[model samples]
Target: MSDATLTRIAEALERLRPAPAQTPDWAAAEAFVWHADPDRLEPVAQVNRVDLPLLLGIDRARDTLLENTLQFARGLPANNALLWGARGMGKSSLVKAVHAEVLAQNLPAKLVEVQREDLPSIGRLLSLLRVAPVRVLLFCDDLSFSHDDQHYKSLKAVLDGGIEGRPENVIFYATSNRRHLMPRDMIENERSSAINPSEAVEEKVSLSDRFGLWLGFHPCSQDEYLAMIQGYCAAYGVKIDADTLRAEAIEWQATRGARSGRVAWQYFTDLAGRRGVTL
Candidate 1:
């Protein structure tokens, strides 16, 4: 090719390359994920979250979380929430679903999930979001600490607002099976060997106290469990006889030796497959 033609081709290729997009207005994002290494916010264009109405069996807790989230979405004062309780009881699901619900109502806040291990980087996250155009619902699922873990201190500081305090536009929502977000044995061990036993307990116990709202999830009752099963059935259009469905759901729970929304959902999935129905 001629030199002039080669130069022209190069120029054309350069022009075809896309320019970097502007940093999105965070307020416009409904969901996001925290990237801690380089300290950045990555927007989630489409969040895979269920509608709030689909969650069942934990009526009181659900109502409480929804009310708090709604208030936050509406720019009203709302407390940080700690959802602690039985496994697979929809703690994390409720958080995500509630975020989606509130956003659907055209609220100004967005949801962002950070990893438990990334708690120490929260200060950086807060700094980034502090001035963003949107309010943020920061979530950490199954958050807990081991005996040797010191990151809890950072979390405590952040939740307490530290020197800068938590951002006015941001709120925290965490889910864990442990109320203290630490193992009972760890707390016991600390109490057993620490020079000041009460102080040791205080150090660990105080972390949870930072959250103004403590929503506990208990194992669902048998009737509630059945209601959950029915709810899923109705939502998914899985037709089954009531008596048979109840018998099978009861047997399923018995065989598993536990009952919760998760168990009911799992059983329904199995039942749907066995009955040759797609879920």
Candidate 2:
């Protein structure tokens, strides 16, 4: 090849390659999103989260996670927490709220959200966070795996930390609808197909066991659901008669065929809109 052509090809190849992940300005924001292609931590000016007090149900999960996050932020011993159970019961919301609570108490903690697909790059992300001055809450929301998916293997880096060990300043928190972080049917399938059924299932199911704290979320009661809407209305200053609010909220859930903190919020959102209030 001609020298000029070779030089041009080399320059083009360099441009095509993804840039190395860079540590961001820790003070830039309280929260960030980890993106992998170019491997950057993008700061978020504001986090879209309900206030801690506004998360009415899942109080036990909320308290447990908040305490764990506070301990980690303060450089105390803590556990990698798995918040798993019923959907729309504030599992993910609890994680964010706990981080916010840590900040509220004047602790130096930053929240970095990682998408499940970007988990393969978590080692790089951890490398950046390992040197961070402030504590970091590494959060993954709606985490789950299909039968054929291998992303769970990457998650072990966060949960188990391989040889280098999890960073002292970083704590992992994940939310999932499944307690095992995978479909029950997937576990069943492995059991049925593998020659060593216990071994096959154990490899996958054991991932959840790696987390020291298992916080379970369950469906809210009727009163709890109504209370959630009421709290929102009060917090946002959307006033309505208690009877009317109760009746309307019940009707709303009936039509949707599900009652959850999420459903309550959805109903409250609609109510606030009709009342000409902004959330």
Candidate 3:
């Protein structure tokens, strides 16, 4: 080949190849988010999370996750955790809150959030995190698999970690509305259609089993819902009479047609705005 042609081809090949993933300065922030399409980790200066004490109605989940996270941060053995259950019941929030709590205790832990769609890029992301100096609480919110979804295959990188195994400093915490990480009908369909029904269903449902800890969140009771609002009002110093607060909080949930920690926060937010309180 002519020298000019060879030079042009070399440059073209270089342009086509992706650049190495650059690790961010971990000291810049306590939390980061993984993004694909030229994969990068973007630091979050301020994480939008409720205070640990403010999260009510999930005390058991709260304590269990906190302990597990603390153990990880302290460089002890910990399990991959799956926070699964009812909608708006603080599954994701508890993960964030627990990270904050760990930081409060001066533990060397950082939070990294990854979107469900970007899961296919997780292996590349993990390559960067595995060498990180600090412990990583990798979080994925609202995780679920549909009947034909192939993204769950990529999740094995987090669960099994291939030959290297999951990085010691990296612990995973995922939140899902479905306990099995897939729909009931999907499992039932596999049960009926596959030649070996048990094996087929097991392959799908076994993803949740991979997690050593499965913390379930359930719907809050009326009293628990009201208590959550009152706690918010107290924490933010938004004052209202007991009678009025009770009546308004109940009406708010009635309009929404459900009761949960999120509903309480929404009601409390409205009350705070009306009372000229900034949260």
Number of the predicted model whose lDDT against the real structure is largest? 3
Point out where model 1 deviates above 4 Å.
1-29, 275-279
lDDT (Cα, tens digit) per residue for candidate 2, span 1-279: 999999999999999998888779989999999999989999999998889999987878888888888888888999999999888999888888888888889997999999999998999899999998888899999999997899999999998899999998898999899899888899999989999999999999999999999999898999999989988988889989999998999999999999999999999999999999998
| lDDT of the candidates, in the order given | 0.85, 0.91, 0.93
Model 3's alpha-carbon lDDT is: 0.93
Q: Compute the lDDT for candidate 1.
A: 0.85
The candidate with the higher lDDT, 1 or 2, is 2
Deviation in Å, model 2, residue 36 alpha carbon = 0.7
Candidate number that wins on lDDT, 1 or 3: 3
> What TM-score, over all chains together, does every model reach?
0.87, 0.95, 0.95
Which ranges of candidate 2 are over 4 A from the true structure? 1-16
Which regions of candidate 3 are displaced past 4 Å?
1-14
The CA lDDT at 43 in model 3 is: 95
TM-score ranking, high to low: 3, 2, 1
Clashes, model 2 = 0
Q: Residue 74, candidate 2: how far off, in angstroms?
A: 0.6
Error of 3 at 154 (Å): 0.7
